[model samples]
Target: MSTTPTSTLRFCLRQWSAWAPGLETREAWSGWDGTLPHGDASPKVDAMPAMLRRRADRLGKMTLETLYAPDIAYHGQPLIHASRHGEATRTVPLLQALARDGAVSPQAFSMAVHNATAGLFTIATRTHAPVTAIAAGPETALAGLLEACSQLADGAASVLLCFSDEPLPALYQPYADTAEAPFALTLDLVAGDDFTLGTGAACTEDATPLSLLHFLLGGETALPLSIRGGWQIVRSAM
Candidate 1:
């Protein structure tokens, strides 16, 4: 016996932005507070949340009511939230307090979890829709994409996929590596598209500083293409 294929999911890129530590992200984007060990370090660290807030604003007018609304309509659909090193900056301070014999703030500890972003998003949008947060070290982006596709395959009417990452803290500067700018994308599956999705594994030879797979397909809307090398997150676009 053969099984019937599931309905195809269509993703539309609604909003996206690539942010660096010191770079001006948006009019409302704010920077982090603190000095860096290196003069060339990105100075816009504190502004990450503001940038995300701004993105949310541009997508649609965000009100206090809408920010905390429980209906899924505000989010367009259910969501899949992904981050590489989620709230690492936030975690650093908690660790410091533990070392200094300072009482760790419960609020801070709660916010430092991997799913904090998704939780905050739910609070901001008041959407009760199901949300899944994923962290797969260096493969964070690909894992997120695959999970979103899986939700679609599982019969979700639609799904929103978001990806973001920040630079490692100065205390952890020795491990500071890679040049990934924080970014987010919201994809909605729709009917009528000639796209196909598949996966494979192999080493990549691309000389780009960060993963090329992310750069090419890290948005809500993008065309499909043949991708070779490395473990890739694949999505077919019609």
Candidate 2:
């Protein structure tokens, strides 16, 4: 009973790379921090504020302060924040502490939530606009994009879709071996555009996580595609 978006949205992609250990830097397609190679080179626990600034730098000429400033010209758009593995690195330590002492640091618990990045973004940008956080396993990226498209269809002027994922702890390394990279994309709907929505069907079978991810990033495909139980597929800009 839902209607599709009549107009398409505009989007841009950003990524962080080389921040995970045991993973080659070439595997990363986004932010490329040199921390992975050095075992003891973890960014300071309180360096998130500065890291956000550095990540925001990829936007070119746009600073975190300017993007999140109160008087900025955001025009009240919606947001979809995505992270397949949200702050896993930060949570591991807290989990270890709780396992040993039956109590955890309140700050660490709060900071490990899936929406932590979104909260920080809101605080830094000083924007009270609607925001949604999604953690859809490997499909986090597509899920976030779909939500952004939904907002645009519902008449939102714009939507900022951000995705980030850090490396897991050594104990959880068996789950995935991908490099640490955070990718973010900001999308805005506009009328009278030359691009057209792609078409495809999503089905759940035995597709690799990276394959699905590549499909989303490749663009220029049809929708209605089947996605696995934990995965999602949606149209993207060309």
Candidate 3:
């Protein structure tokens, strides 16, 4: 419950793009009522080259679509891609194939790794900028955001932060503890003081990527998060 500005992390959001079923537009997402929508919501990924698009799974497509969305103008900024479960849907099947048939396709094995989507993005865009992939349980989004902000503080002009997750397939649904839909969010962030992330009161609310998106969308003045030792994001005082 310590609200100190001295240790606050500060940054400015240049632009953001989010994609989900029936919530592709900011106007549509403004109506989100804390309930994730249910539907196909698969990303088109038409911007990706044909070969890459064919190789990308649903989650990969979602991530690429958000990063390449019309609103996001990528200028080779370093990328930090985060997901609580990176390509889980793809990995599970690979595991099953190994268990059942005692072997799996080598090509599929390559894409089943945690950094597949990030690698695909770099290959597609031919970006030489550094790329970092992260997976930190439920704190995945916060970890990615913090990394981007730290890059800015370390002399980087800007950073591209992306988070993507989809509902676990039916086989793993029973083990799921949190509610989520097929969604991806991309943020173009630069050095500034428009917002602050600092220590905050403890609460039960989880700091899911969707929660961060709502705060960025101006739906809330302060985002209360109970992860990573209790944190919050708010507009810096003028």
Candidate 4:
């Protein structure tokens, strides 16, 4: 009856940033008590170009806000963007328009893809490095972390791993298996011994993007993430 994880991954966390309604500051997030705030307010995107900001949806704005946070010094490292539902707001509307009127705005169609926000981020920052988009249902964050570690193992110096998602549109709310709120979090990961990832028993809590943030901020020894069969990240004892 051994339940300990057999496989493990170790990595360093250089810098981190997170954004959500009423929890935009490090102080606010540090005091988070597992309660999510309700709001339509999205993160500010003034750092992005006017054109890019104008074209970006709410999720895109959140991504830009977290990525370009003044607190973190992001210098165009390779990026891994993960989301459970990418561009659902835009994609859902496009699908509805297509079904109802047989017409979809070309602009909307272009931005409906999962990589649209990633593309926008790179364009805004003028980062020519590789950017990978990941959508692995509930395992999106885990997948993004693995991808970042893989790149580090392949000789990259650093990688920016960002997890961003929002509540699905009202049309798909009924199909939602778990409640979600709008949030974006980024961790600048490098090669070091800051944390370890491994498998464990399933978790019953709401394992949304914010959960990862809480785990990192709360100083927990291990976070039992409800991902894949089950996965967890343990802060390194070193």
Report the C-alpha displacement of residue 204, candidate 3, in angstroms.
1.9
lDDT score for residue 212 of model 3: 86
List candidate 1 segments past 4 Å from native. 1-73, 189-195, 205-238
Model 3 Cα displacement at 122 (Å)? 1.3
Looking at model 3, residue 211 earns an lDDT score of: 80
TM-score, structure 4 vs. true: 0.91
lDDT of residue 10 for candidate 3:
86
Off by over 4 Å in 4: 1-4, 200-206, 227-229
Best by lDDT: 3
The total of clashing pairs for model 4 equals 0
C-alpha RMSD for every candidate: 9.2, 8.1, 1.8, 2.0
Which of candidates 2 and 3 is the stronger one according to TM-score? Answer: 3
Q: What are the per-residue Cα lDDT tens digits for candidate 2 across 145-223?
A: 6576667557765566554454566778887745544323233333223322322333454332233334444553433
Error of 3 at 147 (Å): 1.1
Predicted model with the maximum TM-score = 3
Model 4 lDDT at residue 42: 85
Provide the overall lDDT of each model, using Cα atoms, as 2-decimal numbers. Answer: 0.47, 0.47, 0.83, 0.81
On residues 114-135, what C-alpha lDDT tens digit does candidate 1 reach at each position?
7665665666556688878787
lDDT of 3 by residue, 71-175 (tens): 899888899999988888888889999999999999998887878888888899998879999998877767888888889989999899999898988888998
TM-score each candidate.
Answer: 0.60, 0.58, 0.93, 0.91
Candidate 4 worst ten-residue window by lDDT: 1-10
